[model samples]
Target: MSERVLIPRNRGFLFLDSHPAGCERLVTDMWQACPGSADMPEGDGPVALIIGSSAGYGLAATLAGLKRAGIRGIMVSFEKAPTERRTGTAGWYRTAATADIARAAGRDLVFLNGDAFSDTMKNQVADLIEQRFGGRLDYLIYSVAAPRRTDPATGTTYASVLKPIGRANRTKTLVFDGEGVPEVREVETGPAEGDDVEQTVAVMGGTDWERWIDQLVGRGLLADGFATAALSYIGSPLTAAIYRQGTIGTAKAHLEATARSLNERLGRTVGGRAVTSVNGAAVTQSSTAIPGIALYTGLLRGVLGEDLVPPVHQLAALWDQLTGAAPSDLDDEGRIRLDTWELTDDVQAAVAERWEAATTDSIADLADLAWFRSEVQRLYGFSVPGIDYAAAVATDIPWPDHTA
Candidate 1:
């Protein structure tokens, strides 16, 4: 893959096919960003399974967990195509790079290429776990992100529609890159509420998570005391309606509810536990498309550093807690609001204060600009310490071979 032009503030969207060394360098930087030090855990047999194990924080959490614990396991991912309309490819390049890093670290890695939503894929995963790990797994992580899914049994596909809630929402958001913020008006001229809500739930919420867990248990493949978790997000109230209260919010609610149900069901066999991590906002490919979040994220970047814990950091912290290395930072419901650092009353209050005071005339200042750039760089495998961007990138690295 050829190197892409790097924009000053929008490096987060660079989306390069990073080389093995570059990927490992960033992984190490993020590993140090966590609190405390723990040896990589040593054990065997399906120690961990990460669904949606390809990009963004999903990939980060997997690497961090493995690095910290020194555990090895399988990764089942439904990799998505890059937004550039890359033809006939779905993130194999990334999987290959990550595999190279894992092998170098003396960690065992397995990458299964298939849809996690289908029975064929689900059964395939169960067989792999059962055969390789003695029908038991210590950890299961659900981190897939997509717009929609077609239910194999129901023959109905679930999808999402982005729109305004409550009185024609008019808001300002960051533009294409992180350079500037712009005013936007969200209009809802699409489907009706019932249709949209159902579709959103079907596409983005807990059903798939529940199905995967159920399949594992029924196949007698889950080991005792297995722990499972799914990632969720609840931004500030300003953006909550668009994120947490709209179609996506409805899906998250279902996801949270699913966690409760799964925890109950897994009580005996594996002491099944369900956790929801309300992560902070980052400059991910998906978050950049959301309305009104960029400005808030930018504001957060300025205030959060120097003892600041963003979403990715929180994810690493939470992974540590899950693996029995640290205590949890959970709320009353046992679900951790990891995003609290960015959503704190003080933090949100400060950002809201900035929002109201900001106009097209008075946009973000140098502080905000600096924060935006740093956070943006952190998103796309850059700006993190110890990574040499000048390193050569290779796209032909070998993918993990579980069969061998």
Candidate 2:
């Protein structure tokens, strides 16, 4: 086995083979957090179809659906295959590990690897549902994060930008060197221009999500009284400029509007519900790449302390919300509030104090840099407990029969 080194790029860590033990540990943690089968309502649980179900919140929801509700599922993702010189992405291994666990428990799992935005992929999923699962899906979860998207109708490509809307906003950013030391540097981003917001919306907004729902309904793949949701976030004020009030924010605003339209359409057409769940901020591969978010996450962890929630925990909460066991907790706009605790007054006050005091010298004391770094490492399937780092693991693992 060659020496495994953590390479820090501007975005996030790049690594080779995943620690199989770590992958297994992730599955174990998810199950431990899951609701038991007996706790669920009587019946073979709902049939769930998850888009972008390879990593981050999407993957967590997939695990939660199977373990918590005993639901059969189909996952759609776009990931690379392993090569002789390199291992596949961490998501590939995570999915493989999850499939093994689900199969052992007698749960049905199907994985589709392709561009979810393409028409071909949509047709394939609809056909598979018709042939395999009796042509009816009860749930749909959309959680895709991509830098660029190619429109299937026009074949035009649009890219998402992470700039503030009106003016150049100056802020401090933390850049890690893969050695646990982070340097704080002042950075500034110019405003978006020249249809930048439009492009971002075209790529990351709710159009693709609405399209998926429409296609599924048109093919009669969605069962009556089905439910659908797409993930969104409204973070702390510190990140509002670049995130919530920026180009991405414009896209999100559009997404929220679409959710309202979808709710009405789903309710009338299939006696179903559609919602956009506002989630808490967590360290994800995409979040780490944003300009000011890493610094904000470190401070948030410092203030929230043990109250900080990971993706798995958030998914568990979502399960409880979706199952009608608890209150739906809808806000004035009719969007679900899964992030209410994160946006509390006391938590924001402490984060604000630390945000002002944050600097290169004060970061070590004011922010939870260690926790942030560990989460980033975990995203790449490293820094996990009980993993033999020196083992010569096979790079290419076969996909499950259903997915293959």
Best by lDDT: 2
TM-score of 1: 0.84
222-254: candidate 2 lDDT, tens digit per residue: 798888889999898988998999999899998
Question: Tens digit of lDDT per residue, candidate 1, span 245-356?
Answer: 7777888889999988888878855776878877777766677767677766765665565545644467677777787767878888778777776766887777777776
**Candidate 1: misplaced stretches above 4 Å?**
1-25, 32-39, 80-93, 165-167, 177-194, 370-393
What's the lDDT for residue 119 in model 1? 88
Distance from true location, Cα of 24 in model 2, Å: 3.6
